[model samples]
Target: MNTTKLNPPTQKNRLITMILAMFLGIFGIDRFYLGKWKSGIAKGLTLGGLGIWWFIDGALLLMDAFLHSLGKDSGFVKDARGQDLRLGLSMYRLKDGRLQRDWFSS
Candidate 1:
């Protein structure tokens, strides 16, 4: 029998996600920042459940950040800082020489 092992994806810039989740989760800013527009809108419509759901979400984001920081693949979205605006959502290098956006994979 032959078996193949699949590697998990890695997350980048988890610290920013955690911070956004903790401070602006009610507005779904964390989800939006993470590229989850649907979820972000839902969270925004709910007002984060008077802070309860937001707290939970923040905790989860923090946990995800911790795992990512430890070099563990958590399947979280990578936050790229500095990218060309013309690239529209795809990964691009900004004038400052920093990579931003994961870029739509073709």
Candidate 2:
């Protein structure tokens, strides 16, 4: 059996979250940002799990926007400047950028 402990995904960035969901989100980009690793990859290749979950997938992103508007600021992360940063949620870039991983995610 896998030893990974399943923790609730972390939320990150409002605008960036919306953009990711708006564009690459259909392929699980948003979930990946929220730290839902398995779901991200699956949704990415399966096109929101065969497109049947299109609404549900979109809801995930909408919920983030809704929550942010309510000042539920958990998604905002701190940057090197010690200010709340609106960073995009991405595992990789399509071009001219680097990919990153969260070693502690699992």
Best by lDDT: 1
Query: Per-residue error at 89 for model 1, in Å?
Result: 26
TM-score of 2: 0.47
> Which stretch of 10 consecutive residues in model 2 shows the poorest summed lDDT?
87-96
Best by TM-score: 1
lDDT of 2 by residue, 1-106 (tens): 5444465324345466567766787787766665667877888888977675555656655664444344443433332233332322333222224333322223
Structural RMSD, model 2: 12.5
TM-score of 1: 0.53
Report the C-alpha lDDT of model 1 over 34-102, residue by residue, as the tens digit: 667877888999998778779887776565544433334433344433211112222442323444433
Provide the clashing-pair count of each candidate structure.
2, 1
- TM-score, every prediction: 0.53, 0.47
- Misplaced by over 4 Å in model 1 are 1-12, 75-106
